[model samples]
Target chain A: MKNIKIRRLSKEKLNKPALHRPQASIESMHKYRTDMYEGMIAETVVVRGHGGTNINAYFARPLGPGPFPGVVLIHHAPGWDEWYRETTRKFAHHGYLAVSPNIYYPFGQGAPEDVAAKVRAAGGVPDDDVVGDIAESLSYLKSLPQSNGKAGLFGTCSGGRQVFLVACRTKGFDAAVDCWGGRVVMSKQELTAKYPVAPIDYTKDLSCPLLGLFGEEDQFPTPQQVEQHEQELKKYGKTYEFHMYPKAGHGFFYYDRAAYRQEQAVDGWNKLFAFFEKYLGTTD
Target chain B: MCTGIVENAKVSGSGKGPDGWYPLDQASVSYDHPDHAQSGRAIIIDFLNEAVGPKARIAVELTPESARNLVHAILASLSRGEGEGVRAKDEPPQ
Candidate 1:
């Protein structure tokens, strides 16, 4: 380690917490897989998750499946944005039951523009509450007759951060895939809002395998920061794999945004599917 | 807030497979001094925009079973050269 004394800018102004929308509409609607790669069953349902949270979840069953594997998709910080739902549908197009919950509920819901102000005014919800809601959703999936009782987790942005925290806090998930969410580390001052779990303290207790995908160009938490975090994981002896996309930025996996890079997103999607197949597949 | 984990198996380093430990890719690791490979921390600065403009990225890879192992290895290695204080204590003869 270099004995370099990196000067801390003591007079620098503290960054104001970014205002964020707390939740999205739980519109229970159904849509089919656009093009058939085959074995894709699509449907929408309202699920009572996390102490009866009204969550809009989507299920995609295998084409000829008596029963199929399941995946729980957690949405990013902007709430259940449009891209989150589309991603859920895409998971349905694949051969798994995918469920996504708008973690920012109970605070308020409205257009993206309004929710942020309301959330900030309401003092934000804790991370643990969201995690509990996700856990309840998992239990709900397990109880479903069509599901094989095995579930994996996937998330983008804030959702990505949640996946890692959940993997560390609970052993229920068979595997977890986190796409560019690294909010696991929060400072004392940053603890103004409530959180369901403490990722920093709990990361070492992680039992499940995890895969983290990051855009090399993410501005919020740079890839280097993410890599540094990975180094932290080395101390805990928890297994994880990381993929850094060369030319992608934050929300690069999102199809609706200009930031979307189809090639990179597809590559990530392929890797995600393969990872699930390896870890969540049933030999029986 | 940087928090992450890198776990590899004992034989083949992967999360899904059976238990195994990862042998650090020494070749890829950067050390302050070549002769002091195990002593100082290695750093790698990668480009942030690997896809477009080249950005800087810095990383260090090390092996220990758990967080405990990581802390011990880092502290010991920094204080002494390589495995000086890191050697397992010898058992007393019966």
Candidate 2:
């Protein structure tokens, strides 16, 4: 087997390209916000990660950068969404080289909107596999020139759970932020309960300091469950933080959805950024 | 569905210039699982011992010295065929 070459991408190659085409100026002026969504900061390219798999990732760097710290943004379950993209952009905005891998990309080759359905169609993949995919993204990010050798992990929904997993399983992540992903206890019965099943049972291996945010009113995972997860983390002696908002529900941080709670979402975002700044800022 | 038998493999070292491991460009060739070739990780020490010849100098590209551990795991999976029972080896440590 040929040893995979670990190539570091240059800063120039990581910039989002300007798309000021002829006819699109009128549409670009609309509130759809083309500038936010359309920049091609990273290519839909493949890189060799752990286990020699051709991992797919979207990488973005600071607008005009030196060697900035890096962040691996794991997407919520179902699949990647606009929120994932914005989260990556936010990391880039904060002067970090942010990379988000489409963990379900191997099964879904279409636009981001189509990923959730594709994930359902692929049946359930093991949680370790998902965590492996995250590790690959970290490897890819670390190989980038703009990565500044410092890295962290962040995620929302199921992605949040992944942040915790990567912190425990991988070495590259110096910090982690999990938004509303419960530490599930997986069992044979619980495994079959949800499609694309969640193996919440394997969280004992978490090794890094993690910060988790949850909604008190979420039906799938109640505030009590979130507290239970927090207690479990404490039992493991892992450094972690857990927050429960009284009134928010699932997808509260998602601005595009009707369930959006701007105030709570902003508070969560600020806290996450602060956590990253404190833990990863100096390390990276 | 992706499966293959190991025909051969070469061990190579991380090409981080002078800072890399000694004796670069060793490899292991495998007919099956072309994907696993990139990292050059294997599952058993003796497995690599057999493929690369005993005490054969090989180079690998990875951070830290743990790439050997990763390689042992990967090679063990390939030799087991279909990777079914092999999954247990990676089970989270209790």
Runs with alpha carbons beyond 4 Å of true place in candidate 1:
A1-43, A52-54, A63-65, A109-117, A120-124, A196-198, A282-284, B1-94
Q: Score the docking of each candidate (DockQ).
A: 0.02, 0.01
lDDT of 2 by residue, A32-70 (tens): 343563232644567554456776777777654356777
Docking class of 1: incorrect
- Alpha carbon lDDT of residue A46, candidate 1? 73
Best by DockQ: 1
Return the DockQ of model 1.
0.02
Window of ten residues with lowest summed lDDT in model 2 chain A: A3-12
Model 2 regions lying over 4 Å from their true place: A1-43, A192-204, A282-284, B1-94
- TM-score, candidate number 1: 0.60
Q: State the C-alpha lDDT per candidate.
A: 0.56, 0.55
TM-score of chain A of 1: 0.77
